[model samples]
Target: MEAKLYDGPMIDAHQHFWQPQINPHPWLAPDVLIPFRYGDYSAIKREYLPPDYLKDATPKHNVVATVYVDAEWDPKDPMGETKYIHTVAEKYGMPNAVVAQAWLHADDVEAVLKAQSQYPLVRSVRHKPAGALSPAEAQSGIRTLMSDEKWRQGYALLAKFGLNFDLQTPWWNLHEAKRLALDFPDTLIILNHTGLPYDRSAEGLKEWHKAMSLLSDIPNIVVKISGIGLPDKKWDINDNRWIVQETVQIFGTDRAMFASNFPVDSLCGDLETIFTGFKEAVKDYSPEDQHKLFFANAKKYYKMKI
Candidate 1:
């Protein structure tokens, strides 16, 4: 049987746009190459504006809208990235929404969040909470963990301005996320990268599934099934189908949405290849459920007007 493609309009719940030349993305800087999950990312270190994104996404996928997440611009000036994206959107007419950057633990977090909230395009904020490298080190009382009172103080302000949170952390730390969601039941937490199941080992997937299941129990949290690309491995349907399907199973269609995580995931495959894998993985699902995963859920979760 031929697999059906999701031909409906898509709202890319998460992606990025950057011009390191104009704004300093220290991580993407030529001399400051940090370790990346997809190994060398020199190819994407250059400019990736809306045209480039459209070039990669269109003629293959009907990405009607997009939500631009922060591209790790200069932490010294968090608003710089947001301003740059605003300019990009004004000119390009894409990126219908945005997830701005603000360090939840920074002393100036309140100021940053307040400014970010005024932007019409800004829909949420992302501050990758610090986490333990392994489950063994997770008990060291990391001050930057979500449990940190100071961090929570800053996090509490999100509700004041009606901002959602985009959480990007490894699976093992989701225990903390579950608690955080419960503590702030009013705020919505969108978990990024499908809990980042990087370790494909049997025991590794077991732990990932356990964490996702536990986190799914929280009603306030939603999940974006993105950034599943593996290091040193091609983007293969056989490799990623279970991860995509299992995420929907854990979060259900209402709480889960598909995203490209593009240019970043482009390290593993083109946008077409990545979206095709997603479409193929869930071809058997009902059309209504497929619509939610590919489009409707993102529109609702991100509060996209389109």
Candidate 2:
């Protein structure tokens, strides 16, 4: 059955806007080529400000508001990204919320968290915690895992500042995530990219499913169902439907949200293709549940003032 298009207001739970020319994003630098999920991201290395994003989203989707996730800005000046986003929001009237950057284990973590909390638009912070490369490597336990005392020391500070954490680790490290959530029950942990289920093999999916199920048992954690695109493939519904549906099934409608992960995700497909695929994937659900998945959950999770 073809899913009807949703015309309701949406709060993009996760997306980014960057001006690499003005503010330095090392990853987006001309010389720096990091291993990316979407292969050659050269197509998106240019300045993608609010106007660029709205051109891709508006008229196609009713995008009432958006939450700006931090693009890796120059770490030497962590607060620079948040300040720039505030200016964009003031000028553009979108990105009603901001997920600023913070290095959880950095020497200046405490000062950074305190400063980030001061911004009215800042609601959450993302510090992609260090994790193992593969399940085999994870078995021995990496020192920088969320379990690390120094990292936990920094993570524990989130509650004090009334901030949430946006976690972007692979599915294999969710066991570590579960423990972190249990220990710090007060801090709301928003899992990015559906726990990053990149490996699509039968065995890979089984592992991903097991990891997702394990993490779902924790009440403090929620998930954003975005960034499921593969390197060399187009963003087709057939390839991503199961991952989206299974995530909502595991985390429940209230705990899972749909996001664009745009500019970066644009490397795979257009915004219309991604959001339409999301609407179609869960069209079997009731309207209320659909609304929660696409809109309400994001607003609530990010404390978006929409």
Candidate 3:
């Protein structure tokens, strides 16, 4: 029951591209390593571009188009990643869509959003707000910054540019996320990594399920089913299957799509193994439903022409 056969071309709705060599990602720097929430992420500290991504994604999963989610790069040059992905998209014909980053609280937020919006492939923006509930979580260097007026002002700019939002935050904050979704009814909100149910305990998962259910009630919100192993870096098909099935059940095929999360998930297993687990998890669904989860939904959600 945990594994099922699924063969479909995927439109990877979520993934990332970063060149640590030319651009500085302080988190990815080798010597200054710290414990990340995802646990022992040192394995992915090197440069990863479309070529490397294609090498890992193709001949196995049949990734026709992928959407590049923002990788935390040097904060000083927020548009750098967009420029880099443009080159990759032009050369490889992959990453047909890009979700660039812009600090929602910055004084020049509009200027940044405008610059990012000018890029043809950019369809959304990702500026993960920090809203940790516990002192430990706060000390972990994660922020809980959603309610700020300045940030909301910046969030308002997305509608002006006609860009959607890629939201990556802890699950505890989904209630606030729901409010934001309501406030901007016209703006599309894509929730990253299955609400990031970082806690795998029975109680933790139960809490995660509750939060996701509440967020799913909002028509503007869509869930990206990936990062099942994030809270704990171990992988199990059955556990992942339950998360995948529960997400699709709650949001339905039209509102849910699968993403590789690639190098981040590469910490758990190879690309084939990761996507195979996803395919197997949804094997009982109809071919059309599987196509929606694996391909069509991403194309629609990301607004990718390919």
Estimated TM-score for each candidate: 0.97, 0.97, 0.92
lDDT of each: 0.89, 0.90, 0.84
Q: Sort by TM-score, best first.
A: 2, 1, 3
Model 1 Cα shift for residue 117 (angstroms): 0.5
Candidate 2: clashing pairs of residues: none
Candidate 2 residues lying further than 4 Å off, grouped into runs, are 1-3
1-306: candidate 3 lDDT, tens digit per residue: 443576778888888877676767788876767767667888787878788987997787888889998888778889888898899888878789999989999999999999999999999999988778653564575555556778988998899999999998877788778889898888899999998877778888898898789976788999899877754445778767778889999999899999988788888777887788888888888888899999999899888887
Query: What are the per-model C-alpha RMSD values against the true structure?
Result: 1.5, 1.4, 3.0
True lDDT of residue 79, candidate 1: 93
Sorted by lDDT (best first), the order is: 2, 1, 3
With a 3 Å backbone cut-off (N, CA, C), the pairs that clash in candidate 3 are 130-143, 130-144, 130-145, 131-143, 131-144
Where is model 3 poorest over a 10-residue stretch in terms of lDDT? 134-143
Candidate 2 CA-lDDT value: 0.90
Model 1 lDDT tens row, 156-233: 999999999999998888888998999999899999999999899999899899989997678899999999988888
lDDT of 1: 0.89
With a 3 Å backbone cut-off (N, CA, C), the pairs that clash in candidate 1 are none
lDDT string for model 2 (141-210, tens) is 6634497888889999999999999999998899888999999999999999998998999999999999
